[model samples]
Target: MEMKIGSKSNKIKYYFLVPALTVLIFMTIVPLIFSLGVSFTNYSPTRIGSWSFIGFENFIRTFTDSEIGTSFINNVIFVVVSVTIEFVLGMVIALLLNRKIRGISFIRTMFLLPMMVTPVAVGLMWRWLLNTDYGLLNYFIEQVFGITSINWLGSYSLAMPSIILVDIWKWTPFMILSLLAGLQSLSQEPIEAARIDGASNWQIFRYVTLPRLKNIIFVILLIRTIDCLTRSFDVVWTLTNGGPGLSTELLSLRIYRLAFKFWETGYASAVSWLYLLLVIFITTRFISYLYKQEF
Candidate 1:
């Protein structure tokens, strides 16, 4: 009787799991497979009712297209520069806050306010603040340094840097939060021992704290890389719309313009798949390192 009851309970568990698994497959796997199929074809949405399989053509164009090449380079530069600055700034802030200072809670809360705002809202707010004629930033510069108003988003040279600045402002808090949590959760024994052995602050940090925090740092880097590479659409879209001659066009924004604006569905799909593969490659490498550290 007990065996029979156990079997029934197991069957009930499978029954509950099936629907969720089915939904997951439909939502993620189905679209992925469909899009992969579309990437190999000449399937422009503008020309309805007729499409043919043109295998590898779109993929070839993705490599040859100058605009796409420029966008890809811009994305690489954005991810590298922005993520590096955020990590450094975040580490400094996290270390400062890790100290037992008064009102640290309030300071941390204030630091996180930028991250809490929606990306589009942040983009809009910065857009206004950086406006050439009426922007507070330009106005302050004019008043303090006696310089004329400088166009931020409108200028080709400054457009990409401005976008990177906005990204750094909004996302650095996330790095602070992650690194702070890692710092707080660290076991104090090694640090205490190092201190008792007459180790200097810099020495302790370099030899003791950093080695211990490697896993957390790697995880933070992985997460930030994936997010910045794939989902940096809203801010770029709102701020410049890839203006100033595609100076700030990220891969995601480029993909959006191709699909929606130009209706090149097949080419967009191919580019997106290539982008996905790049992300997967980088993430997989990070995961491998993480696993090595784990074991």
Candidate 2:
């Protein structure tokens, strides 16, 4: 009788999972499989019923297209420059915050406000501040430094850098919070022993704190890199719409333009699949290196 009751309870639990599994298959699995099929066809939404398979033509074009190449190059530059700055600045801020200063909690909260704001809102707020005329930033520059108003978003040379700046501002807080948590969780015995050995602050950090924080650092880097690659659409779209002659276009924006603006759904699907593969490849490498370091 006890066995029968236990079996019935297990069956009841399985029945409860049925709805969730059904939703997952329909919402995620089905769409993914459908899109994979669409990527091999010439299925322009504008053409509706008159679409057919074109083998690997779309994938071939993705490799040879100059515009895609340019967008990819721009993305690489953005990721490298922005992530580097964020890591450095975040480490500094995290170190400072780890100290037992007065009002440290309040300061940490204030530092995180920029990250809590929505990306589109950050873009819009910065857009106004970066305006050439009568903008707050320009006003301050003119008053404090005697510099003329500069067109931040309108220039080809400055457009990509401006986008990077916005990204850094919005994301550096994540690094700070993540690193701070790692620091707080670390066992204090090693750090205390390092101090007893007459090690300087820099030496203690270099020898003790950093090595322990490696796993957290790797995790945050992977998360941020994937985010910058795929989900930076709102901020970039709002800031410049890939303007200044595609100077600030990312792969996400490129896919958007191809799919919606140009109505080349099949080509867009192919590019998106390639983009997904690139992300997966990078993530796999990151995990592999992390495990190697651990072992």
Candidate 3:
């Protein structure tokens, strides 16, 4: 009887789990291997479902392409600058709201409104505001500020910045929320101790606060880095579509164009792999830095 029950339980467990494992292998593992395999080939709709393996040629050419090179450089700049700006600004806002100010919860909720809005919606809203002709921004600039209408998206110089502006507006709330969680989770004893020791706000933050929040900060950075790289499609696609002659062509955007626009599946696969590796590398370094986290 016991053996029969044990066998029945084992069968049920396998039955329940096998479907999920099969889906994983088919959806994730298989696609990854296929994509990796396609990265080494000349696969495209034009090729009639045939592949000619050219080991690393796609990667080599992608790196060597000057347009691609420029895009890669701009991607690096965007990641560093945007992430830094968002983190710092978000930290500031989170700190301000952490105070027991009047109506602070309401204000915190308001700050999160931008984050709650859809990315595509955020892009559209910003696009309308930043439009050079009759845009609210340009109108304000020309009429009230006595400034010329700026070509925010059209101009190469301002396109990336415009993207960053929209991103910061949408994502700063995320930073604030993450840091707020960190702040709320901190034990009050150390903070109170610092207060009693005649430490200035700056000193307290520098000594007592920042250290404890390291893991939370790193975790947010990790998540936001992945998100900013992968899920930036709606904002960039709606705003620029990697336009102004590829001035804002991020890696994901570049991969997208390669696969869809240019129909270079192999090349797109290569770009995707390389970009994925880069994100993983940066994230891994940060993860490793605080691998044995206290939290």
Give candidates' CA RMSD values in order: 2.0, 1.7, 2.4
Of candidate 3, the 10-residue stretch with the lowest lDDT total is: 286-295
Stretches off by above 4 angstroms in model 3 are 1-14, 46-51, 290-295
TM-score of 1: 0.94
For model 1 the local lDDT of residue 59 reads 99
Residues 118-236, model 3: lDDT tens digits: 88898888889988886898888898879987999999999999998888888888899889988988889998998998999999998889989998898888888788777778888
Q: Rate the local accuracy (lDDT) of all candidates.
A: 0.92, 0.91, 0.87
lDDT agreement of model 2 with the native: 0.91
Per-residue lDDT, model 1, residue 175, is: 95
> Number of clashing pairs, model 1?
0
lDDT: worst 10-residue window of model 2: 286-295
Clashes of 2: 0
Better of 2 and 3 by lDDT: 2
Ranking by lDDT: 1, 2, 3
* lDDT value for model 3: 0.87
- In candidate 2 the C-alpha lDDT for residue 11 amounts to 94
